[model samples]
Target: MHVVAIYNNKGGEGKSTVTVGIAEFLAANRNKKVLVVDLDAQASSSCALLGRQSLNAAIREGRTVVDLAAQLKQTRRPSIDPEQFLVWRAASEARGSALESMAMLVPDGDRMYDVESSMVWGKHNHLFRDWLKPKLTEFDFVLIDLPANVTKSAMVCVNGLAMSDFVLIPTRSTHISLNGLPRTFSLIDQVRNVNGDGFPTVLGFLLNATDKRNQQYRSIVRPMVAASTDGEIPPFFQNHWPASPALEAATDEDRDARTLKERFGNAYDHARKVARELEVACEKYERTQVQPIKLSLWQRLGLA
Candidate 1:
C-alpha cells in the first residue's frame, strides 16, 4: 500500500478538504481501498468524511485517534493497539458507493489538543508511524490529513510522513497561503535529517480553490512562481482544484458519495488526474532509491 500525507505548515489551507475529496475519488474512480487517518486535532476531516453522529459515537466508545494517541503517550505501559479503533463503513449510507471500501481513523474533539500537548520528542513522535506502518500492505492507499501548523500533532505527522512514500502540500494561490510553502519545506528538511527514512518526497504543491478566470492569479502569481527558485517547492501538479463550494458542501452536509460525485462533476475529473499523478510518483519513488532533497529554504529561513 502507498501512504501519502496531505500536509502544510499553515492553517486555512484546505488540507482536510483535499484529503477527503481525493480519498473519495480514489475509492470511487480508482477502486482503491483507502484509509484516511485524521491526524489533526481539529478533527475537521473526521466530521467531513464521517459526519458528527458517527464521530460522536466513536468518541463515546473511546475509539478515536485522540484516545489512541493518549494510549501511546503512556511510555511506561505496553503500547495499546489502536487497530481496534478503525472506523469501518465510516461514510453515510448515501456515500456507500464511493466510500464502501474506505475506512477512517477519526479524531476526538475534546482530548485532541491534550493529545498534541502530551507528545514528547521520542515517545510519541513515532506513535502514528509505528501504528500505521504495519497496515500499509493491507490497504491500497493510506492518506493522512495532518494538522496545519508546527504543533506536537504536526510533529507526529512529520514523523509519520518520513515513513510515507509521498507527501502532498495543499494550498491556495494567494500570498498568505503561498508564504507557508518555505516553512513547510524547512520542516520537511528537519524531519529528513532526524527521521530514519528521511523526508517523504513531496508530490507537489497542490493549488486548490484556484480560479482559472482570475487574471490576478494568471498574471501575477504564475509569473512570480515561474521566475522564482522553486526547487524547494517541488513540482506543481498538472491538474488543480477550482474555487467551488460543491467540494466542501457535499461532505459538510453529509451528502451520499454518489450525490457528491454529481456535485463535483468535472472537479472529480480534476481529482482523478491528480490521483493519477500521485500514482506515477508513488511508483517512481518505490522503484528508485532516490535521496531526499535537502532544501535550501532551511538555510534561507535561518532554520538549518
Candidate 2:
C-alpha cells in the first residue's frame, strides 16, 4: 500500500479539502481501493466523507480520531465491532463520482489494552503501522488527513508518514502559512532519521486557494518556484489550485464530479497532473533509495 499524508502546519490552507479530493479521485477514477484516515481532531475529513450533521453528533458524544486510534491500537488490529470510536460512513455519490468511506475494523477484543502497551514499549510508538500492516494489501492507497498544527495528534501523522511513500504539503500563498513549510519538512526528516528506511518523500508542495489576480501571489509564488529549481527549496506541485467559490458550494451540496468541474474549472485537471508528478517522484525515490537530509537544531527551531 502507498501511504500519503496531506499535512500543513497552518490551518485553513485547504489540507483536508485536498486530501479528500485526491482520495476521491484515486478511488473513483483510478479504481484504486483507497482508505482515508482522519487524524484531525475537528474530523473535517470524516465529516466530508460522512456528513456534517452526522459528524457533529459524533463529536458531541466525544467520538474523535484519537479515540479511534486508541481503540485500534488496543485491539492490535482494525476494529470489527461498532463502538463510539468506530463509524461506518455509507458511500455516497456526487456528480456521478463515489466518495470513499471508512469501516472501523477492530482486530481483537483488547482495543484499549494493546494501544497502551504499544505506547510504552513499541518501537517509535508506531502502533498505527503495526495495526495497518495486515490490512495494507487490501488497498492501493491509504490517505491520512493530519491536524493543522504539530501536536501529539500530528505525531501520529508523522508515524504514518514514516510508512508512506509520499508526503503532500498543502498551503496557501500567504507568508505565515508558507513560512511553516520548513518546519513541516523538518518533522518529516525526523521521522526518516528514526525509521532508517521507508521514509516518505516530499512529493510536492501544493499551492491551494491561490488567487491568480493577486500581484502578491505571483510575487511570492514565483520566487518559491524559482527557489525550488535553484535548490534553495524543494520542488513544488506544478499545478496550482486557484481560488474557487464554486468548490466550497459544491462540497456543501455534496456534488461530486460535475460540481467539482464547474466550481474548480481546470483545478481538477491540474490536480491530476500533480498527482501524476507525485507518482513519478515516488518511483524515483524508491529506485534511488534517497535518504532524507537532517537539519540542525537552529534550522528546526526556524531561526536558521
Candidate 3:
C-alpha cells in the first residue's frame, strides 16, 4: 500500500479537505482500496468522513484510535488491531465500488490529546512504525490526516509520517502558511537523517483555497513554489483547489453525492485532476529512492 500523509504545521490550511477529496477520488474513481487515518485529537477528519453523530457512536463503542492506544498502554505493549479502530463506509467508501474497504481510524483528541502522548512516547519513538507498517500491507493506499500540533496531542502521528512513502503538504497561498514550511522541512530532514534511514518524499504542494485572480498567488506564491523545485523540495501541483462553498461543504457528510463529480460540484474536475497527478508523483517517488543518511553519532557508536 502507498502510505501518504496530508500534513501541515498550521491548521485551517485545508489538510483534511484535501485528504478526503483525494481519498474519495482514488477509491471512487480509481477503484483503489483506501484507509484514512485521522491523527488529530480534535477528530475533525473523523467527523468529516463519518459525520459527528457517527464519530460519537464510534467513540462510545470503543472503536476509535483512543481505544486501540489504550489497549496497548494498559498491556505495556505496542500492538495494532486496525479492525478495532476501522470505521466502515468512510468518506472514500463509495457504494458498490469495493468491499469492506476505505475504513478510518478516528482519533480521540479529548481523551488522547495529552493523555496518550506522555504514556507512549518512551525512548523508542517508533510507536506507529513498529505496528502500523506491517498492518498497512492490507490496503492499496493509507492516507493520514495529521493534526496541526505535533507534541500536544499526537506525537505518534510522527511515526506515521516516518513510515509514509509520500508526504503530501497541503498549504494555502498565505504568507503565514508559507512561513512555516522551513520548520516543516527541517523536521523532515532531521527524521530522514537518522542513520541514513528512509523517509517519505514530498509529493509536491497542493494549493488550497486559491484565487486565480489574486496577484499574490499568480505572481508571488506560484513563482516561489516553482523556484523551490530542487531535488529534495517538491514542486507544486498543476491543479489547485478553488475557494468555494461547494468545496467546503463537500467536507460535510450526508452530502448524498454518488460520485466525486456530484460531491465537489465545479471543483470536482480539478480535484480529480490533482488526484491523478498525485498518483503519478507517488509513482515517480517510488521509483526514485531516497539516499541513506550518513552515519550519526549513535550509528558511529554502534547504538543505532
Per-residue alpha-carbon lDDT of candidate 3 for residues 159-266, written as tens digits (9 for 90 to 100): 667767777888888767776666555555655554145677777788888986898676557555545554334678888998988789877766666556666888
Better of 2 and 3 by lDDT: 3
RMSD of each: 3.7, 5.5, 6.3
Candidate 2: segments with Cα more than 4 A from true spot: 53-68, 71-124, 152-155, 212-214, 250-267, 287-304
After best superposition, candidate 1 residue 27: deviation in angstroms?
A: 0.9
TM values, all candidates: 0.84, 0.74, 0.84
State which candidate has the highest TM-score: 3
| Candidate with more favorable, higher TM-score: 1 or 2 | 1
- lDDT per residue as tens, model 2, 50-94: 666666666566455455556555563464322445556655555
Q: After superposition, how far is residue 218 of candidate 2 from its true place, in Å?
A: 3.4
What is the descending lDDT order? 3, 1, 2
Q: Model 3 compared with the native: what TM-score?
A: 0.84
lDDT of 2: 0.60
Runs off by more than 4 Å, candidate 3: 73-79, 90-101, 120-122, 194-196, 230-232, 287-304
Of the two candidates 2 and 3, the one with more favorable TM-score, higher being better, is: 3
TM-score of structure candidate 1? 0.84
Q: Each candidate: what lDDT? A: 0.69, 0.60, 0.71
